[model samples]
Target: METISIQWSLVLFTALTGIAGWTFVCVAADEFLGRAKAAAFPAGIAAFVLAVVGGLASVTHLSHPDRIMGALGHPTSGIFTEAVLVGLLCVFVAVYLVMLKRGASDGARKVVAVIGAVFGVLISFMAGESYMMSSRPAWDTLLLPLGYMLTAMPGGVACYLVVVAAKAKDAQVGEYAKALLVAGVLAAIGAVAFAAAAGQADGAALGCVVAAAVLAGVVPAVCGALLPKKPQQLMALAAGSLACAAVGIVCYRCLMWMVSEPVANLFLNIL
Candidate 1:
């Protein structure tokens, strides 16, 4: 039997960073929009911790500090671009969190929030773009990056929901539910684009993609919708949404690897 393998570090890095960094985006929305102002500080801290943890996981495969520095020097490399973007995301988030703690003016924190949101989006796209290569035809597509950005939103936003929903009013919870539904739609588009790109993907891989959309996308949206009705079940619903996001993300990434195909050996084909 062929042992299917993947870049485990890359997978973890992409999923974790996407989720954690995006969580910051949601936290920023709460602060900027004044939906959950009080929750912003605590939620921001959660996002920072998770983002840092994910950043550390990405370093596991780097092996040496020199190799990391070398990669950073090459702006042409996708790894370099992704690393820079994620780093900026962490920096902005840290600044925003500190400003919140220091009781800085909203203008300062808002500036950081806007900057961090931009980085969050860029890093999400780059997470998948870094995987694209001429050698791997299956990995090269605009849709892959879009999928990375979109599917990640559900999980990332779900993290914020987990932290903020308890004190959030019914109307506020409804707004979050609406956001989840939108994320679900985006997930559908991105995940389907992923399946469409894999011309030779097996049924198993396709099935997993469908499952991912539901777990990472549909289930969370549904939970958010129900949360307004079940006001007392805040923690349970929020956690379930986050859990689904994590599992769905892993499932999607794993199936993506299973369907990967290198371009046919051109030299051998010509023989």
Candidate 2:
């Protein structure tokens, strides 16, 4: 494999979109728990926008964007699989949004929410799994998908907290902030451990990755959790945390890309 191209479009698609989808799940889960409807509309809008942006970013990865339709013919291809999942996810979110707009019954909304959330999870899985290649030891571990899932947890929580603070003033959002802080710490530790185990055992890049994870995830989580439980205070904390966590996720992706070393399979006997 040649040197990996670092494209801003692909980075946005993989990290931001993954976080956005996971945020949908978190918002829906809060609703399912019988929380107030204050966040439903905003969450739906966010999900739809993220899906659209992610799809467009994907298009940028194609050299001949017009030929992208040809990808559909190869259903087994990773690119195709991601495209289909993202498309379906967008549809599910749109359906949910439509139902909300029309003032649909609670039962109908719940069903659509479940469908959207499920598709969101599948999209995150495909984002990481798409990079799975045995030739690249750094990208071959199950840790890649697991790391995405873990990081998404705090990102989702932080985003939903912001929505809740702005729209609902839900006191329960603080609890989520606390939970996310603990989760962020755990995720940071897990990330470094996984990186070390997966051919990045020791290097300046690994150190940078570890530091970013702690800063991007752990520190914000701690601050958010420590904030006063007041709705207004929590909201401010959440906003700050969201920015930090977003930066952390981007750093993690860059490090993962940097660590990708393709194994050379040269047989001297053949020569």
Candidate 3:
């Protein structure tokens, strides 16, 4: 397999986006449950800030960062459209945090919760399309978006479960942990199916598939299953699995960048 320099910017952006999205979802969950802890505020703030930074880094990867606003103005540009949606979602999250700090009424918080869920789904879809829209055979799949959403949900829940586990003596962290584990497993399965369906028969492509399978499938399953025994260990496991998933994503992107369409009849002429 030929090694290429991975785009560190994309990697950073994707990783941070995963973490930030998880944070935002956790905060939303806390609000939904009527939790008024100060820790929720800090998590929400961090998530909002990180999400904005991640979105900004994504723009910097474009050839025309200055034209980003114009890209958003274009109706046909899916990438730009997604970027705008994510930006809006981040703004909403920030505003939601502000309202929480100000002791917003239940009715007002509920309104924000509804909006957050909508934007959360939108952001998840856009994140999936970030890879799925690529010409690379390895990434262009309907399952990509669903898998991204699944993976993100667990991460978000895991973060929330951790905080709740620490603070609430009577809280059932096991339920959240179990939910996260299940989501991770489903995402891993979807990712594996996508890789199998799209992978080339060549050595490089085969190597990529094997690497992705180990990282995205096997590792996560084993680690996720161990969550019930040790909560702290489970947290570490979740983090490790998430990291592996991120690496698999990067590798998948690299493979897509490297692979090219097979030329017809050229081999016949050579023969």
Candidate 4:
């Protein structure tokens, strides 16, 4: 039997979109919490741009990109549902930024923020669900969505801290960054444990997975947690940490693509 294969284009697109969604969730959370106003515009715009790029890159995965519009009409399909959630998230972030620019009421902005956060998480959940292919044993576990959430949100929060620190230079943001780092460490650990529980990976694949987890979770957590208290140091540290975390996420996704074994057990496995 033939083993299932990974799709790099889809993987890249999902990583970009996943990060974009999580970034918006972080922005919205900050907005609602009233902790960082200056960070909103830049972060929101960044998220929107990421979403656009990912949405476009995803077309490469489709044999008929021109026919992609029909995806919007089918809410029942996981891909369609994920697409809709992504679109809604981008819209909400865009609208929130516009409202901010126009000096809209806090109440109005809060409403949009809440909406954006919801859609962000829903997108993450859908991302995992989208991979629930019965043909690929490794990708079929329920832990997939939880793993996505665990990694994406922490990555997103780190991205937000980088943006905010760069633009705002607010020392107070350090505390929040620290909290996020701790959360990220915990989430990353949880994700790794969950993946182990699935019992799909072995040997070098497992080693790579663990190493990717460290790069994604431990490195960023330590960097974020140990960020210098000075405002000037914060920006550089946060940005570097964010970049590291991103590489980790990409590694994780690549491994996910690499580890699948076909359910059929016919011909040789792809990995």
Candidate 5:
């Protein structure tokens, strides 16, 4: 049996990027739907910074970080697609921020937000697709990558709500509460579906995946339903939701290795 040895760098990359990407989409929702604009600028900055850090962590996994951009030359590779998507995410975020600073039209900003939201969401999917392999039964499915993307949304919504509550007084977040609940349910369904796809080969792997599903899905759903109106309490709920999402994401990474040999180690051997 292969041991469960998760890659810390990849963990950080996936978790951070997932959160960042989802947060951006939430922020974009605020822009497109015309919600609380007070936290929009700072929230966008937070998402952008988180993504940059996650991108850096992703490169750390490679022996030749300096040549990482060469990935773009191999368009057929999932990794190459992921790299390009992340780049597009950064570019979109930067342009959106710049337009905000220069007082661009609402229509123009919404256009940027629409584009940014698409790239932001897709990066997580590509990240999971990059890791897909036939050797690992758990990894060889669309559900895993879809789980990666769906599971990330609750975290993103929580992070965005945190900023909204923290930065604004008496912030109105009833609509956001609904978003959190929806994200949580989707996350739960996705996680469990992925685990089910694995066909119960091991106790530990199934345990991790199932537990992650509950944590990532149930907590946010409950919190969102009972979301406090007070700013501080709302912040607390949001923080807790984000933490649960993080734990779920990291556990999924552990599940990847628990079910099969360390794929990263295989690459390292080749190098």
Candidate 6:
């Protein structure tokens, strides 16, 4: 295999997007559990920051950032176009945070929540498509988006659980934390499985699969399963797992980018 430099823009973009997606998930899960008042504003702000940073990094990969507005004007560009759409979604999230700080009504909050969730899902898919759209066999699998979604959900939920566990005096919050941990574990397993299967056929892909499995699966499992019953331990496990998932996703993206594309007409000469 020939040596090549990693695409720093793509790596940074994926990392920021993962963080943003994870933050949104945690916030959404908090809302679902009736902790919206506490989680909503902070998570919204984090999401907005991450989304803006990721969006800007993505634009850096383009030939012209000033032409970004013109790119958004075009409606038929698919995932590339969706990049602008996700950026707009992040702006809405930022506005939602402002409204939240100003004491929005329940109805308004609900509307923002719904819109944010929709965009969260869209961003997740857009991240997956960024790689899957490439001709590389390592990333063309249908599982890529599913894996991304799974990792994001667990990472988000875990973060929310950790935050709640740290502050809430109520026993009910502990139960919720436990539940989210279990859910996160399951989601992590699914992500590891899908990534493993997707990478079974190629060397670069296999390396990604192994790295992800260790980070997203084995580490979390050992930490979460072996620790004594303690809130702090659980929180630590959750945070570690989230970190692992993020790393795994990055490795997956890097592998996809590393795969070499064949030159036109080279196949004819080889035969």
TM-score, every prediction: 0.89, 0.87, 0.75, 0.88, 0.92, 0.76
Mind giving the per-residue lDDT tens digits that candidate 4 earns over 114-194? 898888878766777777767767777877766766667666777888888777775367556775677568657755865
Deviation (Å) of 122 in candidate 2: 1.8
- Candidate 3 positional error at 77, Å: 0.9
For residues 183-203, could you state the per-residue lDDT of candidate 6 as single tens digits? 446555655666555544267
The whole-model C-alpha lDDT of candidate 6 against the native structure comes to 0.60
On the 0 to 100 scale, the lDDT of residue 113 in model 5 is 86
- Candidate number with greatest TM-score: 5
Question: In order, what lDDT does every prediction score?
Answer: 0.76, 0.71, 0.60, 0.72, 0.81, 0.60
Off-target runs (Cα >4 Å) in candidate 6 are 1-5, 161-205, 218-228, 233-235, 259-271
* Candidate 6 minimal-lDDT segment of 10 residues: 262-271
lDDT for 75 in candidate 6 is 70
Candidates ranked, most accurate by TM-score first: 5, 1, 4, 2, 6, 3
What ranges in model 5 sit over 4 Å off?
A: 228-232, 261-265, 269-271
The residue pairs found clashing in candidate 1 are: none
Top-lDDT candidate index:
5
Worst 10 residues of 3 by lDDT: 262-271
Query: After superposition, which runs of candidate 2 have C-alpha atoms over 4 Å from their true positions?
Result: 1-3, 201-204, 227-230, 262-271
**Candidate 3 TM-score, true structure as reference:** 0.75
Tell me the spans in candidate 4 whose CA falls farther than 4 Å from its real position: 1-3, 228-231, 263-271
lDDT of 1 by residue, 1-271 (tens): 1214666777788888888778888877766577777678777777778777777777775657446676578789776787888788889988888888899998888888988988887887788887766776677777777888888888987888888865453426666767876886777667877878866556777677887788887888787778778867777888898898888887777766767754443212111
